[model samples]
Target chain A: MGEAIVITSGKGGVGKTTTTANLGTALALAGKRVCLVDTDIGLRNLDVVMGLENRIIYDLVDVVQGRCTVQKALVKDKRFDDKLYLLPAAQTSDKTAVTPEQMKKLIHELKQDYDYILIDCPAGIEQGYRNAVAGADGAIVVTTPEVSAVRDADRIIGLLEKEENVRSPRLIINRIRGHMVKNGDMLDIDEIVMHLSIDLLGIIADDENVIKASNNGEPIVLDPNSKASIAYRNIARRILGESVPLQSLEEEQKGVFAKIKKFFGMR
Target chain B: MNRQKQQYVTIKGTKDGLTLHLDDTCSYHDLVMELEEKLSVNQTNEPDGPLVAVHLKVGNRYLTPEQEEEIRTLIRTKKNLVVESIDSNVITKEEALGWKRKTEIVSVSKIVRSGQILHVKGDLLLIGDVNPGGTVIAGGNIFILGALRGIAHAGYYGNKEAVIAASVMKPMQLRISDIMSRSPDYKSEERNEMECAYIDDNNQIVVDRLQLLTHLRPHLTRLERRL
Candidate 1:
């Protein structure tokens, strides 16, 4: 059976959904069959980010509640050509609609068919979070390079470590402003990793295009050249047992020569 | 002199109070008989005189609560004789075990993460870091061999004399018994060296170098020795 991994963060607005979408897309791009399960029942956004919102018919609640079969609830993403599927959460129901035991059984059923199952956990340590972590073989904790995000990540790691089923969670420091980190204005990836004291999978830089892609209903990993997209791909490769060195996060200021070079290439 | 030594009961009046001595080696039956007879002789000259307090000393003998109460009832018959205290040289096995637990040191090696609490009945020796929002409480003392970035309440069971020592002492809050010292009030020392906290003579928890623990509570290291 394939392994299931849960992506979780204790606090809200820390790029958990974004990380989940990008990692799911990246893993699928590597020719591995991947199923992305969204456990954020009421606050469902994974389908929209994956651009599969319109195709969702039977959701996670319907499958868990035995209203529909697991196959009927899965939404195929034509972009990956049968490699990627999105099991969207129900937008009408809350987290209590599903329990951890039911989720564990459902995930176990899905694990038989997929190469990798990535469960997108909710923002808090509530029923949704527990349900997402119930059957996972591993966990990934996402956070930004800020005090609040790091503190919340610490709390989530504390909870995840207590789980007997889930493996030790790794760290992903997202939204790293290169210039800000260079100027000591923000917490660096090293500082965040050292503070959290977990293995660093990869670090995603603060790219505004990440927001643009999410708003446009596209996973950032589709754009392979972008900083955040490449970071996601690296983390995905690391998860697949490949050792990839971290990309440098210090984007320096444009010097006068670069400005003159840009003048020469006038549009 | 030999017959006096053989007697199971002895009563005397010192300069202050009357002392009642019970022979421990004699049979329980004989001891009770001699005690009753000795006090019965004094019951005749009783109520007319003033109340005289007596101290009962039972050497190397364990007395059950019921047997002690029986002795107290027998003393009550002598209206003039009042029992002040009962002293024994031996304690129950349960009490001895409790004393052992109170002095035992528990060694733990794990990251005390946020919102997690590690508490023990006796002294705690943690070999891992305590992240912020975590707590470690001990009935005796807390000794952390790693960083302490959280709250530590030593002497949780009202042991005001308990102490907290850490390799990296940056605790957000420190409590020794009822007294507490929070950040800003406590010098937020990010010092790398080891530091220990204890209630000083001023009744305030003070953080100082770890070596001072030997001077502050010299008896802390006196009970057990390691080669």
Candidate 2:
């Protein structure tokens, strides 16, 4: 069985789907068979970000309801042949369409065939979040450098701790701006780590390439040269039990190559 | 050890005092016999006679679900029983008898947060602050190393001899057994102090400085101290 990972943030719009898409692709790029499941249901977007939305004929609801086999509903990643698959969410259904037991069963089936399973959890701590995390071995809580986001992340950590299966949840601070943090305009990386008091997975700096990749319906990790892509890839490596040095968001912005990369991408 | 084992008695130590784990299956007479045997063993270990206190761990499985009140009553009369987790699942009679024997010492390792009501059976040793709106009800003593701003009921088994000790005692209310008391309007002069409360000779609960109040709350009175 493969390792099930849920990318969850208690508050809405914290880049959980983006992290899942990129991590899944990065893991596959590293030669591990990965399956990315979008458990957002009605608010599905992992398929769109991975450029596999149009190819989705069957969704997670279909597999859970016994309407289709698990393999038939899996959307293979076009960029990485036989390396990555996505269990796209159903657009027409709500979170209640799938039960935790069914979700566990689906992930159980994928565990033996895949090396990694990334579940893009829904915004709130609702049925979707529960279902997505039911069979997960670990979790990544994505949050922005904001008070409300950190607060909600704290709540999600508390809820996850109550579950007997969940281990210590890792933290990912997305959209971090070194300049803003330096000027005392935004919360710094250390502050978030201290407040959340959890293990830091990796941090994704504010980069326009993320938005660009999303707009282009592709995960940023495929670019390898993109800074956000590198960060997500590092996180993926860390998830696979590797100890990598966390690149300071400040140090990355000072380098000339970063400036040129940003200029070329118009970041 | 074998003689004591036959009596179905187990013993543990905590910051408050000793906690005795009793076999619920054992008859009341056998249970007391085991307690005496345990005390004798302790007497040989420490050269002190029954200096190690005893507390009972009742089997929640054998006790009816509705018998929580009865269990609580038993604890009060015995002035030592610590009611452990109420068994709500499929608990067999034999399993219930064995579970109580393997009870671990109670240790609360996190900050008792708001809206949390934790009823600890044994002595509760808090590693973090007991925040306001939180609660800790222990059948034995409760020792809070940090600020205690919540409701704490220690010696809940009518053990007026039990004590509530904290570094900072700013609790909204405090109770030991059936005796209940609250801070005077939250504006009283004795708001922040290392103090202990116990019942007086007149049977009224009184609070005094740890050094000055020779008699603790829920037990001895100021007059008794002089005596």
Candidate 3:
């Protein structure tokens, strides 16, 4: 049976959808049968990020409500060649449209066929988050280096640890600006992990291409040389029980003249 | 006369009023019957003078508040008698348990994460970090062996004498009883020593070094060594 892992951040605009899309694609790239379940309901965006917006006919609400078969609701990702599929969330319906019990049943049915089911959770810890976490065997708490995001992640982790089905949740620090961390401006990886006291799954550096690729309906993991893509692949390998070393981030420093200019307070 | 010699209810005169000693070995019904008979016999001596104050003493017998009230009502039924006090040598087991719960220290070893609150009846000895947005409340004192970056409310149940001590004493807010004091806004004070917060004589929450607790609350130490 497949394992269902929910990707959630208690605060909004923290790259939960991006992580879900890239991780699912990375797992698919590793030849694992991956199913991405979007549980955001009214504010679904996983389909758009995966470039499968036009393909979604029957959504998560339809499958759980018995309006359509699970096979009928699944949108296949042609890029992965039968390796990846997405169960989109219904844009018209709210979080109350689906119940946690129905979500659990639906995920249990999907687990029989897929190797991994990544549930893309909504922002708040309400019904949508509950439905996303209901069937999750494990969880991935995504957060940025910002204090607000970290605080919300801590709250979510506390909630996740109380779940009977979900195991110890792991952390993924996303959108880290390497230079700001080097300059001791932003919260670094070690500080956040120490504060949250959870096992660090992986960290993704902030790259311009991530936003650009998402804007074009393609996840960053499609580009092999993309830094964010490489990080996602490493995270996927770690999820597959591979001990790949975490990629250390080092910002591109300028020449001696730039350092002199920086000393003189030049931009 | 033999029954009078083995009386279960004894009354004695004092300068202020009279003291009624109820027999600890007798049943509740027998004690009530004898007391009623004795009071009725003395009814002729009453009503001519002012009300006689009566103090009921139950030796080695624990009486519930309701039972004590019943005895008071029995005495008050007479127009010349008024109950001044009800004294007992023993207490109910529930009261003993409640006292023990209020005085004993509860030890916990877990992270009090954000949005979570740990509450203990008496003193708390927490061995984990209180993350930001988390809270730890205790009826007695609070002693944290780890970082306290969140809120700590010692004496939450209105125990004005309670204190909160932490190893890394950097909390967003500290409350002792009704008084609250927020940590200084500056984050540059990085030298985190063992610190404690307690209510001062001026009715304010004061955060100071943990060492001050030795002089401030010397009675907190309950350890007695004979060896």
Query: By TM-score, who's the top model here?
Result: 3
Could you give the candidate ranking by TM-score, starting with the highest?
3, 1, 2
Candidate 3 structure quality by residue, lDDT tens digits, A1-267: 999999999999999999999999999999999999999999999999999999989999888888999999999999889999999999998999999999999999999999999999999999999999999999999999999999999999999999999999999999999999989999999999999999999999999999999999999999999999999999999999999998889864589997888789885
- Candidates' interface RMSDs, in order? 0.9, 4.8, 0.4
lDDT values, one for every candidate: 0.89, 0.76, 0.92
**Candidates by lDDT, descending order:** 3, 1, 2
Off by over 4 Å in 3: A254-267, B2-5, B11-20, B39-56, B73-94, B223-227
Write the number of the candidate with greater TM-score, choosing between 2 and 3: 3
Clashing pairs in 1: none
Q: Each prediction's DockQ?
A: 0.63, 0.06, 0.78
For lDDT, the strongest prediction is 3
Fnat, model by model in order, equals 0.65, 0.00, 0.82
Residue B71 displacement in candidate 1 (angstroms): 3.3
Candidate 1: list runs displaced more than 4 Å: A252-267, B1-34, B42-70, B76-97, B185-190, B224-227
Model 2 regions more than 4 Å off: A251-267, B1-106, B111-124, B128-227
Q: Per-residue lDDT tens digits of candidate 2, residues A128-194?
A: 8899889888888899999778767877876787777778899999999888998989998896786
